[model samples]
Target: MLTDTVEIDQFIRPAEIEAILDQAAAAPDSAIEAILDKAARFEGLSHLEVANLLKMDDRHLPRLYQVARSIKEAIYGNRIVMFAPLYVSDYCVNRCAYCAYNECHSFKRRQLTQDEVRDEIVEIVSMGHKRIALEAGEDDVNCPIDYILDCLRTIYQTQADLSGEIRRVNVNIAATTVENYSKLKEVGIGTYILFQETYHQPTYERFHLAGPKRDYWYHTTAFDRAMTAGIDDVGAGVLFGLHDPLFEALAMVIHNEHLERTYGVGFHTISVPRIRPAEGVDLSAVYPNIPDDETFKKIVAVLRLAVPYTGIIISTRETAAMRKDLLDCGVTQMSACSAVGVGGYMAEKRRRETGEIDPTLTAQFAKNDERTADEIIAWLMSEGLVPSWCTACYRSGRTGDRFMALAKSGQIKNVCHPNALMTLSEYLEDYASPEVKAVGYALVDRELEKVPKSQHREQARRNVEAIRSGKTRDLYL
Candidate 1:
């Protein structure tokens, strides 16, 4: 058994979590319903309450899913915020056992030059993505903080077809000092996303055999530093299948609670990424705790109930059917038509146009949802859902506890709904295919009526009309 680590105790008490899990396993139907009632109120749940819901059996899962959907609708409505990943580099010094970028891998490593970064952003913009999560492997020598800032400058400055550009760039890189985070904030990043990989200290130390990432305490405390450095919006998550899923889920709740206690706000978003097969890793041997489809859905639902106000993100790692199912279970954000490798967008476009695969282009992980962005947007519209590209809150100064206060008070919809429609209209006019554009226009027209009439609504209407008439672009409330 691994010895008790101070880091673990400082964040989460394993024995307390375990004891709550045991109690939850034996919770009666009335007790479970009481917990669901609490979730419905959007008041947020305690760690013990979350553990009980996680311990629920399949018999109670249907109710749990229903409550989750209701809570999601109450908070975020039908708008699904869309983004794509832009991997600028694959260089690494870490020897993580479950990643292809592990230092022990024999594959060729590559980092994009400023020109290559511009090209990638162009392709991404042409696909109608206003938001991107810039990803990179850890390597101070190759991908230092300065390189990251330069890439950010390149992305924000490079204009795509018809003056389209990346409006938000959330970064997913290795943890560094508060000074580095402040630098990223100065460059105008949307969110500082860093996955803990796993919250279990022993499991974290085991997977990260060699590198700066091997220090569990340093990695776990990264959010505190970022928040202190004045980056209000931070995203946290764990790679499921690394350890017991229940333990990881409970630990996530503990983490969010800690952030709320210390920083006055928790995670702005919580990403749920399950481990998948990679070049250097044996999926089955290294990650034996992978959850089945039902189990995974339950986890997402529980997370929704546990943190009703925080945004939940579902990535392209899941299948189309699974992603669709999860949307109702409180997933407010999603990555559509994502490419997970360095220079992956260019490579994928080339492969689609010509039937040749680029041997030099390596993917960080294989994608399960391979639909194009247009297809995903069209499908979402057909289902009465709005595929939103809105970044108004971040730009308009509604971040951190301010945003949370509005979200909790149910007033954000007035702003979010109108902005979502305006951005959707802009997408239809600029980047969408004919078929998608037709469906999207109809959806936008119908959704316009739903936006409550006010000064902002009138402005959004004018912006939508301007976009339709080719007078403006990238307009949001």
Candidate 2:
């Protein structure tokens, strides 16, 4: 089962955390420019300036957004990395007060067996998702370390003699021992994700009063442990509504800095999830800290200005209109068609109960924006954004620092956009709905017209037809 029984506690020293925050707080606007210039030249941002940017005011927000957009153009371009969350289980061992999965809640819990998990992956893969984030609750019985590893191994190894590939499998599980982190690396994870929820110590304590995750340092320094265990790419983020947005944003920058200083691998991705009304959860009484839309955009834009090279991900916790508006402003990655229950993707007759399968019995904080993956991609195309499915970073060793460099330069689009269209065409050919296909085909034709040369356009057309004709080739233009 690859289970490790060791009780490990690896944390960043409090003095180190304090030192970073102090430097960040002391940095000035000129200092921030120096940092941004260095990032442009060296392909990495200074952690301190990122934290400083979070403190920027409304007066400078517009300029900050412009710089962020320019930086995004240089690095990621208009290509939006697309993925989906495959909920494997909803059983929890933590009682964090703000979470829907808290154990104190009387909601039913459930887990997917190996076959059920494979079924879920099949559904996701059919939707042309090359990357998936595995979401699980934190109970050993419900989601054992061995089970998670097996799912990954099966995901990667199952199609050894098959046709399609599920290129990357990112995991979002609770904090665990370095030993477990090592096992996950051995199992081959793309990115190990665990949100600090909030970085304010007292608030963190109050929010997570009765769980092992309540240990602030252990949870906060998980990426350090992951990096220590040789997991090159790790993602860090926060639940924005749990604490003041400004404070959380500052803390996130500080946390990214700590990783860069200690392990030389800053967060590869930063996610921002706001609190949503959920089953058995009272949003008003529990989280009075939620930021409004304008404030949320500011937080996102500030982070972009702060960490010019890092990938920013926004999830379905936001509405369609909100996501559409924000994509070009700062976000680079997003989740579509996410369901927060085990076996939730199975067709109705085929669906199995993950804790009763009742609407009132589900684990999601709220219904997602309800756009299918196809619908989302079509929307991206309509907006002149490329829906990317390329896993070149991991495959080509451009992850971590290598990836950061290319992203900061704005040079990544040359490779990313064409490849994204290639992958999008692959999805459209296989599983797109008629409405989706109509929109996607038209978008492809339109985007092809934007290609610089007729020769490149001819090759792209051939690739698209190849993809449609079920004779897909490697997508290296």
Candidate 3:
């Protein structure tokens, strides 16, 4: 097991961050323009530069959004990778103020049995999803690491009624030792995702009233242990509304830079989850640093310019219109048909069938977008976007620094765009509803033409045909 050698203070110096933001807040218009001009090069911005962008005047925000959109297009093109969250357990030992699963709240706590996990997997696969983020709260007794591994094994082994299977399972569990992370890596997990909740130490301490999660240093240094354990791709994020949005944004850049400097690759994905009201948490009582719609857009745009190659994820916490608006600014990945509660998907399915909402099942937080997976996929197609379910890079060994190198050099599209079309073809043929299938297939046909290489284009067309004809599946470049 790897020893803890990383100093959290080195990476997260709150005083330095405050100083930088203070300097940025006083910058003249010419200084802001120079920073923006530098950002246009696609070579990520420094923390100071990011701070300046965050403090720019409202009138200059539109130009910032435009640049972010251009950079996103240049790097990712029109493809948006899609996935869903499968909450395995809601049992927790933490008294976090922001979550409904906090020990203080009186709810029917539950963890899925192996059989129940299999049932959930069937429902998830039926929704035409190839990737899922497995979530659980930090509870050693009720939801141990062994239980998590068992759930991963079950989900990976179980096949749906229609032959649908989960191709990638990204884990979002509590911070643990390097030994546990190594075990997770051995199980072939995709990304080790853990949201810092908030990088501000005071805010973090205030919210995490109890449990191991309250240790700010240990939680902050999780990626170091993960990387040392040979888990190459780690995802990082902060709960946006927990602190000053600008401070959190600057801290995110610093965090990414620290990882890149140490591990040779930064975050594989950055999730932007804004806080929302839950069963126990009252919005009026808590002082969440919720940015206005326009300011929120600017935050996403600045993050895009700060880390051009990294994937920025926007979850269902944002409204459909907000999600749509931010998509062009920087978001390259999103969750669809998500259920934040333990056993929520199966309960939701049962409710749909019987017209009875299950009172026992409780959500972690409320979602703003309530569309089904097929509905979201169809919407993406209508907007001229490719809703991708491709997991080729992880399975093909193009991860960590290797994936970043391909993305930075503009070569990933040659593989990713075609792979997206192939995966969407599979979704349409195997699991889409009639209306969604029609839209998805039409979108695939048009997108396949945009592939740069004629050989790849022809092969993709043939692969789609093979998938449709029941000859093959999971074909990718």
Candidate 4:
């Protein structure tokens, strides 16, 4: 059954998933320690093992957090990768019940022109973000593949009026054919991200009522066509509140397993986005299924152990407090100063001081964290976390199976650590506020000492001074 093609039925079996969770509920306490020990060693866990850990009682929660933190420290070190989201359009053909941009809504729809995208980039770069996830709603006739390509080209090529550059662009769009994905690859996208929304076919169909997205097989197999087209680094996720979170988690692990067996690599990143309040969606049917803070932490920790090699992303949908707490439970990447709407960043930035609204800004979902990117980055540093701006791996040739091998062997730290500090140096020089710049530079020096090799530390020191003296930009290992 493990063939070259993607089969939805084989990838996610609802009955099999139900049985796994049911059995895990009766698993002895000893099973928990055994699984946690393996996870601590970074061997990763099987879906059945993850299911049992998901059933961990309140008493085992501390050990779960400790193992997850240890694995994160061993693999990714202490830096949290940061990126921002730029919504090109909220125009859509879908009537999904959980979205604010559901086609039925009468809100004004807008897509960024090349000029508008340049301005958004100016604002985004001004905030010190070197990477961004390009977001848009699904509408083929109105917002064609050509438009998406144009936006990608504009993002990568334009040197904004303001002083900065967006080095990496990750795109999230509707499912399409292999040829279209190949075109995106040619246009130079970093990661081709598509969320499964939920793996339960019945609920998937129910929520995606009136769009091409309603096709369960096409939506689920998106990664297959993408990888087939040679875009191997794809990020996968679910909306998280649509079905039982435990079942969804198990199904997602199975989905990753299928990709690995067929394509020789699993997901490059896994995003855990919880469904939140949207402009026009009916949430009366959704509130009951939403996971509270404690349950959410449990799921995130289990996911860390379930897929140890992949980067896990949490957006600004969660509160700043919760995002801070999640670090201990193994979240490696987060979006800072993110905009969930077309032109939201610039719109919010200009009126930020006065609290005025920008008419052009329209959000797809409510964001719980309202902090500016700079404020958040400052808070992260104060809490002893490195706010990294590195895209060296992507810009370098390390991706897909190549990146996986380095990450699995725990050797990525050699380059990633120095690369993160070097980029942080660039951010400090070009964008950081005077006070922030001073603190950031000091932190860079301290972390530079831990760069693992005398040679790397020397090179990083020279690069930092070069950036400080305005001699170079975009230096990487």
TM-score of each: 0.96, 0.86, 0.97, 0.96
List runs of model 2 lying over 4 Å from the truth. 1-48, 157-165, 347-361, 409-411, 445-462
The number of the candidate with the highest lDDT is 3
* Model 3 misplacement above 4 A: 5-9, 161-163
Estimate, for each residue in 83-168, the C-alpha lDDT of model 2 and write its tens digit.
88888778888887766777877866777777777777777776777888889888887678898898888777544212256788
Every candidate's CA RMSD: 3.0, 4.5, 1.4, 2.0
| TM-score leader | 3
Instruction: Looking at model 3, report the run of 10 residues with the lowest lDDT sum.
Output: 1-10
lDDT ranking, best first: 3, 1, 4, 2
Q: Which stretches of candidate 4 lie over 4 Å from their true place?
A: 1-9, 161-163, 353-356
Give the TM-score comparing model 4 with the true structure, all chains together. 0.96
Candidate 3: residue 88 lDDT (0-100): 90
Inter-residue clash pairs, candidate 2: 74-410, 75-410
Q: Alpha carbon lDDT of residue 349, candidate 2?
A: 21
Off by over 4 Å in 1: 1-9
